[model samples]
Target chain A: MNKWEDNKAWFLILPVFIIVAFSAVIPLMTVVNYSVQDIFGPGQRFFIGIEWFKEVLSDGRLHEALWRQLLFSGLVLLIEMPLGIGIALLMPKKGWGSSACLVILALPLLIPWNVIGTIWIIFTRPDIGLFGAAINTLGLPFDHTASPFDAWVTVMLMEVWHWTPLVALLAYAGLRAIPEVYYQAAKIDGASSWAIFRYIQLPKMRGVLTIALLLRFMDSFLIYAEPFVLTGGGPGNSTTFLSIYLVKVAVGQFDLGPAAAFSLIYFLIVLLFCWLFYQALQAVGTGDKQ
Target chain B: MARIDLNEIRHSYKPSPKSDDDFALKRVHTTWEDGGAYALLGPSGCGKTTMLNIISGLLKPSHGQILYDGVDVSAMQPEERNIAQVFQFPVLYDTMTVYDNLAFPLRNRNVPASEVDARVRRIAETLELTNDLGKRAAGLSADAKQKISLGRGLVRSDVAAILFDEPLTVIDPHLKWELRRKLKEIHKEFGLTMIYVTHDQVEAMTFADKIVVMYEGEIVQTGTPEELFERPEHVFVGYFIGSPGMGFLECTLEGDIAHVNGAAIPLEPGYGVRASSLGSRFKLGIRPMYLGVHSSREACGELPGFEARVVGVEDQGFCRIVTVQFGGQEIKARINDGHPVAEGLCWLTFPPEKTKLYFNERLVG
Candidate 1:
């Protein structure tokens, strides 16, 4: 008993821990090192003493990208959450039809992110795409190719189509987890349709909805592939969210120091928001318990 | 309160019930008096729950009408029918407080806030849940949650009837008795038209003023507990209603004398005609508690006793259950603790009036 139990059980998990530390911790350490230093080449470096952080914070591009990212995440969450819940409600509760509906809804989520971007890019072309042709035929000078407003609409629509399924799937699982007894009780209570939704369905979906919101928000904020392929940050940086802008600075302009600092700031913002979301969820759970 | 009538309710899931087997609930016609407590009691998959669901409007009959107070409301939804239902499992909203769970139905109907508060408090007190009123339902124990479910159904008194579908299944064994007693008190106080469905005979017998015994999609019998005990209309009812149920042994009847394994037994006159129509498949049913055991042939000749081999003896504190094998058959005899009969050989007797005769799975009068 005093031999510390050998603890071989932890040895079984050592490989996983090592892999995660290498993938996440090592790169994070590299980013931190770069953020604090001025790098001249692969082998040469100098202490910058937070100068790059000051420069990155003062930059106007960072502000613009931050605002755009926030707006996109907010809009995506607002549109997807309720739309997903509504679709889930309309889906059949049982039988072969329910499986068919689930399969159809799950089709969009199966496609790769880059493929989704490519598909939307081709599907929204002015001359060749059905949507673009229909809009042009309606005599509205709609050209996502050259217009910032049109580009933003195209990206938003693509994001909604690609991500709304996730929320819907989560909501569907939540709805299915509810035992039929609750519905029977509601019926016996003589609850109106609205009252049942308000008092029973909504409260039951709280846990899953929190997860859906957080997932959709984080994904929308960090979205790159779809918008990158669709707009390429075109129409003078109108659709340039923070992820796209950070990539442009690090890879395009080759300013690793500022880019690393900017990346750390971006990570902090996400961390702060996620922490806030988690805190809010805990509060709701505690309040419910009381 | 209203008298509800199920008029020739014959329900089938498919387009047609081609054979008798296809009907989940065969034709059932019954009447529940106003402010009367009734129980639909049956074994699992016996169509008792199907009948209850039909009455609750969760399922519509393939043919026939459900009338409430002489008015047909067959096409109405459950809400339109104005009934309360408690399900097998607790169905309270886990996110709401115990008080709010009880107040939900009242608030849904837009009851006055003061009345809602008073009613919720009263129900909570009755359920012994006043201390848990402010606590959310999720963290409550299973019995507490079930009590909340029962309270929710009972909160609204304006409903036409309160239907309970095995509501005590999740309740603890010790608490089940308490809740059953509380339910009886509530029934007497409010005099609501209540329909309880359970497979448990004790719950049914203790709770219902009138019990409807159902088996294999048909209403075999409907009567008070005593009526069910004394005169079971069907062999299934006789076997289903009592503990250790009714023991069935093969027997043949001819001219007022019943023969079991060639052993002649006397029967009341005129029971011969009813037994004669029954083909070779005939049986005698008697409750175990009504059986008497003897140590020797001393009481055998005068009391119409039969010789049997004792297979086992169970000491039940107040009494002993002696499992006896006789005439290539097994029977249970419940005897007072003072009686002593060895395991291998014994004598048993069935009081003539207490014995029930069955022909082709039905009781012969």
Candidate 2:
């Protein structure tokens, strides 16, 4: 009777299991299959056990793309976290002004990723684009299509603009969740502005900030459409992030086996970093427990 | 410690308050002597918190001044006023150790390290938090955290006063007794001016030497607990101050006698003359404890007892409250556990000395 009851519990989960297998497990299995075989044509594949993995891991282009991807994500986190928190702190705590500010902040986030790229592409143009024409008017020789540095700057700006609001919104929610009494108590305790921020506001914001950090890290680490649309692996591949490089390997070069292996490695790296980041943040306020 | 004086303080949150109804605090004119324990007792939105905030300098009143030691400190900040406030919820630096949490206010004022340490240790010990001093404050129980918050308030000796805004609301019921006793001890030992705000009559009666009762943004009465119970200045006070509260009967004054329904209940010697000037319409207020319930006509004896139909009897462990229909209203009379309780009909006695008369919600005589 107990065995039957346990089996009945598993039966209830059959729908979820089937959905996961079809949507996730099956696609992942295809990737794993592709990663292990050397495909010449349809039905003409040979088992190549770890050869593709070895080749993909050792590729000089992949290593450069990996370094570039790390730097980009690191910069995004470094810039956005503080900027987002600062903006949230400056945002009005209540009233119509607060609502207006929230709407304005959400505008960039509402734009489609591809559209953001297209908008930035024109927006950073030297002649017709407002930002580009204004910058060029200062005679700085600003042109993203030609300069790798300019392309990086433009891409970073667009990424920051597109996603910083998410961080700010999260931080704002965290701020609002704090009871008004904490501030009242802090004022009575003679806490200075900096002390209030450090002891009360910052510690309270840790939960949402950790979420913001992990999300920004994972999303930026696997970023694709914006840069691909804006720079398109660019003039000499300066702006080519890991996702763009993976696409080049899979579609541009038609190296399915290598691309599959590279993708698995990419997923592992993001998973590893996200785990490390979450662990680091979670351990922060706890400090040394006795 | 400093004597806190609130001089005609009135406040409104609107940009320009044009009417009396717009104000949260209509008018508060009172002085709290230094080192006296006081509680602002009122229901929610009675402006008790607003009064506390105004005194602590957290809020600037729309009109009038707050004086600490007879010096106007209304324009100053809460920190500048040197006041400590414990909130309804425990407010501690979550990441800090209990010792650090206690030492925070002192440290912020640049108190010497040694003094801070000593004060923190003394407060932690007083609050029964010595062992938890090394633990992060966030990990402690709610009661322990509240102790830490109180410790922070007490750490600085220079603070003018410690204001508590329903600090025990979040505390466990069992722990609330211990914490309230601790506060009482602290108040007596330090002789610091402490103003506690609470809606609970028991908390106000026990923690404070004097209770300031408020209703609808007005200070109806300020007196010792005994005085408030014995002579409630307002109808709201009589209703709010006691468990089961005071029962009021509408009556008309006829010389020294009060006519209610068909019964003629006499008042105290000179009360009828006082009632005649106050107004003809009056209410006789009697505490359930004072109202006498008799099971038999013989028990009524020589007292001026009136006949009433018994409505219901409630056995409350230590005592029984007999609900009876007197005139047209239901009135409760508290009797001792072993006291004989009448079933259908009974006689109720309202002693002239114990009962009070009211006119227009104001105490008449």
The DockQ leader among the candidates is 2
Query: What is candidate 2's lDDT per residue for B231-321, written digit by digit as tens?
Result: 9888899999887899899899898888888899878888767777776788889999999888776788787889998989899999988
Q: What is the DockQ of candidate 1?
A: 0.62
lDDT of 1 by residue, B107-178 (tens): 988899999999999999999999999998878889998899999989988888888999999988999999
Q: Which TM-score value belongs to model 2?
A: 0.94
Candidate 2's displacement at residue B252, Å, is 1.4
Residue by residue across A1-290, what tens digits does model 2's lDDT show?
35433457888899999999999999988999999999999999999999999998899999999999999999999999999999999999999999999999999988999999999989999989989999999888889999999999999999999999999999999999998889988898889999989998999999999999999999999999999999897878898999999999899999999999998999899999989988898888787566
DockQ, 0 to 1 scale, candidate 2 = 0.66
Candidate 1 chain B: minimum summed lDDT over ten consecutive residues — where?
B273-282
lDDT of each: 0.88, 0.91
